[model samples]
Target: MTPLDSSWLAARPLPQPDGDIDKNSRGRVLVAGGSETVPAALRLTGEAAFRAGAGKVQLATVERAALALGLTMPEAATFPLPANDAGELGAAAGSVLAGYLDRCDTLVLGPGMGAEAAATAILSAVIGEPRKGLSLVIDAAALGACADMPNAVRAHEGRVVLTPHPGEMAQLMQRDKSRPEDDPEALACEAAERFGATVLLKGAQTWIACPNQPVLRFAGGGPGLATGGSGDVLAGIIGGLLSRGTPPRTAAAWGVWLHGEAGRRCAEQIGQLGFLGRELLPHIPRLMASQR
Candidate 1:
């Protein structure tokens, strides 16, 4: 494993144009996730996607949380799904969500989604579908749910990007729990090849690998990013880039780099010790400009 250093930071690709036009031309992103306890995940992701230049962001989540998110971010569109008695999305909502899938340029899954029969069923339907125009970014809890679905991975015709932390990667690969400091790149590369999808394994030196290409490592992120909701923000950024028509590999690469850079910038302002994940969101546009 290569240690994160200046050389690794220099390897990241510079930022490119935000997109060809204004918000309408940027592309649409559909963010699906959020259980009762973690209602904030979907909102955080939608905000991050918008900050990353997505033209429009639609969120499909449990009904109760949907109202709050809609009111908070009126720019975002919300679709409330029927929830079970426990206030979590139920299996029956999958068919209802299928209609909206066709409208999005990219799909972002697993931010704050809780484990329940209903959420799993919805995820299965989304993953099992054979949509060609949309891109998919799978992260967090969704990673664990779909890790065993080899057929689902094989069947996906759209661009698929998997973002996993060390523990999540181990779960996906069925390996022992290993720290990101412990050869994460090799393990990530293996998982990417096995699933035939691009993998972004998050850690000190984030590793990005595709089925046949050499693994690319990003080293600029700071320890300030070691907080909850950080991965959710990264997933949203990946979704935003995908919606803008960037390829999975390029989007993952740039998203990871920009996320880390934004965290670093936020740390400088607020100091790393107490910086929150949401605090980093506002800095993304400035970070993008710096990269350009």
Candidate 2:
């Protein structure tokens, strides 16, 4: 595993575009998640992507949240898909998503997506199709969708990233004999190799790994990051960076640092227990400016 020293963090840079450039010149991000039950999940994810520096961000969710989501976020557009009888997205969403997948530089999947057959079908359809030059950040229920199909995203190689917490990690690697509880670093590495993508095993110390790349771990975040929507924020951060032309490894490295650092700051400001998930959004710009 790599230490991810300060020198490396300072030296390895992100894209720096001119002030007059449009959103596309900076990066385009599309977040696809949310069902009838939890519209806020997709909205929060999209907000984090924008705060993290994606110039243009679009969010796709079930029809139940379309009008509300669009009204809440004017800077980013929202598209609504047909919902199934279960009040969740289904495989039919893949048809509408095809056009979106073609347009965005990166896609963030799974937030507020319940573990249901509909979610599984929707994710499976999206995974079965091949993508070119597009990056994917899989989180939440999408991890479960592809759990049984280890090769679901393997064809995409380094273009994909899977963010899973301990429980989610167990779900994702259910068929494997190794217990993720024993060694997170090994689990991350093996999962990355298995999926042919980057894997971030989230915890107090997030372990990031990809095939042929040195493992990077960040142990900065406090218990403040244990909140519900915090992982959604993380998925957005990494997805946002990937949209802006950052490689999966570098993006994961910086994303984890930014997230952990923000959580650390949040904990300090609010006595370790009062910070809300939305509070993390404002901290992102501060961190970016300091890094710049």
Give a tens-digit lDDT track for model 1, residues 1-292: 3443334445654334553566656789999888777887887889889888888999988888889878888989999877787777777767777778988989998788766636457768787776888789988777876667866876774388999888888888877796455778788877887778899888877899887777888877789898988888999988988888887887888788778888888888889767888887888777666554
Q: How much lDDT does each candidate structure score?
A: 0.80, 0.84
What is the model-wide C-alpha lDDT for candidate 1? 0.80
Model 2 Cα shift for residue 62 (angstroms): 1.1
Q: Which residue pairs clash within candidate 1?
A: 90-118, 91-118
* Clash count of each predicted structure: 2, 0
Using all chains and alpha carbons, the TM-scores for the candidates as numbered come to 0.89, 0.94
State the lDDT of candidate 2 residue by residue for 9-31, as single tens digits.
Answer: 78888777777888886888999
Looking at model 2, report the run of 10 residues with the lowest lDDT sum: 115-124
